[model samples]
Target: MFSRTFARSLTHTRPSASLSRACLFYTTEAAPATPQLLVRIKADVKDAMRSRDKERLAVVKGILSDLTYLEKSPQAPAQVTDSVIQILVQKSIKRRQESVQSFQSAGRADQAAQELKEIEMLKVYLPQAMTEQEIEDEVRRVVKEQGATGPKDLGKVMKELGSLDPAKAPKKTVSELVKKVLGSL
Candidate 1:
């Protein structure tokens, strides 16, 4: 009896055009809203695959994987930007640098060389690093702007510098420069 009723209901019902349209609207896949730089990187990944460049492919895939994981997290930004990519690249380079150091200490020159190559590949994506003179100039400007008169005000100047330029200025270099500039005051 239940099967008979189910068959009868199926035969009686017809999906209306409006209902079909609504379903299509809901079911159709939306275009990926990836940033331009990310799109370029993805294209590069394809090229790397075609060329069978294992090292480049691995680095690019790792970046995309990190992006995917970050997007899945609750705290991720609404839209991934190039700046986010830069930050991720910087972190990767830092990790590889540490690995290179450990490998060198262990006398594993081969592994250390591999890490160094990866670091160089990753560095290509980051913006041009600020020269020492440029960083020093920026530090001086921030120090003067904030009226940071001594080492006591180091935190304030550093905080301002971070906002002024986050990715370009190396933190250690900036701190040392800030100290030298502030100490003179």
Candidate 2:
């Protein structure tokens, strides 16, 4: 009788409320949704095609292709998240930058210019980079909070800063800044 009454109450409750309660109790949460960044990038591919913007189309397609490859590989995460996409974009930019340098060295000005354009497009997706002053401020804050003193504490300060701003503070820049701040102590 008690079981019947509880079940009846659940059924009689407002549909939305009952559904939420059922979901919460069952512990069968829905799978994570696709990250919005991936959706936007996919949409841009179509827009580029429609507008006949070959350069934009090429850049977005390259990004999507990289994503597909990663998805199939053993190293792929269970679900592709925005951070994964951002990291991919960063790597793509780095590769293109190197290509630009190579092209410039070879006196291929036109090829180098093309690569620079693609780099600008890719940079749109990444979060704004931290300025030098901002990096210095962050390093100092982390150092103070962690009570780090001298070069010995560099690793501790870096670890905390990484957690705090993984996307904004470029690792190499942050590492250099950390060392500078630590040296002062």
Candidate 3:
């Protein structure tokens, strides 16, 4: 009778280290919800409107306008996922980057600066890009997993990596890295 009570007391008094660690790290509150890119862009547009910031307002509205165009197109998806949004945001930034280079070459530094600012605003919607080191490590792991031994297997290696979360890796950079790794193989 007393043994049962003592055992219960002992259990209450000392949780296993792993259990205690889990309890320490675990959260009761739900993780913050990640809103879609369109939602965030619309919110930013509203904030820009309220602040009378014509520049940011224009950039965000431009993104929204592009989405509307996509929606009206015959090829629009039935549902918009974050990956699609990420791709759209990246494309927009790439276009601006091209414009920035053009403007700089045309001796229009002011316009180039504006484009850079717009790119920054658009970048807010993109997933944080993985570093080169991280990409290299991932490529190595994938090559080993796929038993890719030569440059001829580059496509196979790339396909495996592509199956990962799309927003995390920049495709151009990843492709170049794959070529480098496979060449060394």
Candidate 4:
């Protein structure tokens, strides 16, 4: 009897219910996972499918295909960052814009309109664009910073503007703004 009591006393006591519960809650339930851009794209793709939205579904599928190609390409980077994905999305939009212009010039209004719709659909993945006045102000700032003298320095000014926030201002918009500023100067 004495040996049994001694053996029981030598063992460690169980953790309190409150302590165990707190630890479990803190470790397992404290921080919820935030979805990455890819996860969000996949979710939107599923939603588009469910809603039977062919336009949106086609755009999302195109984006997924681009991303998948990046993953499979031998020269692809170790990881695809959100910024890279955004750049790809911007390129896709630019391509559609070009096609829209081409179709319009060819007097194909219906095809041009369809391309514009696709551009609009893809733009949901891009960051919000800046206003015309805002873009001009930013371009002026860049021109002054580069000490651009005249039209000859246009390339230098353009190079500086290209380094601006790509999300807020696209390269084409920035170029147009720079041209207007230089024309005045």
Best by TM-score: 2
On a 0 to 1 TM-score scale, where does candidate 4 land against the true structure? 0.59
lDDT of 3 by residue, 1-185 (tens): 57998989887886679997888887788864544766777788899999999998898888778877887899996767778778778889989999999999999999999999999888888888889899999999999999999999998999889876667787888999999999998
Clashes of each: 0, 0, 0, 0
**TM-scores, each model vs. reference:** 0.75, 0.79, 0.75, 0.59
Q: Please provide, for model 4 over 1-185, each residue's C-alpha lDDT reduced to its tens digit, 9 standing for 90 to 100.
A: 57987788778668789998888656544553332767778999999999999989989999989988987999786667666678778889889999999999999999999999999888887777788888888878888888886777889988877666676677778887787788888
The RMSD of every model to the true structure, in order and in angstroms, is 5.2, 9.3, 15.0, 8.4
lDDT of 2: 0.89
Candidate 2 residue 131 Cα shift, in angstroms, is 0.9
Worst ten-residue run, lDDT, model 2?
161-170
After superposing candidate 2, which stretches have Cα over 4 Å from the reference?
1-29
Q: Native-vs-model 3 lDDT? A: 0.86
Residues 156-179 of candidate 1 have per-residue lDDT tens digits of: 998888764446776888889988
Output the better candidate (1/2) by lDDT: 2
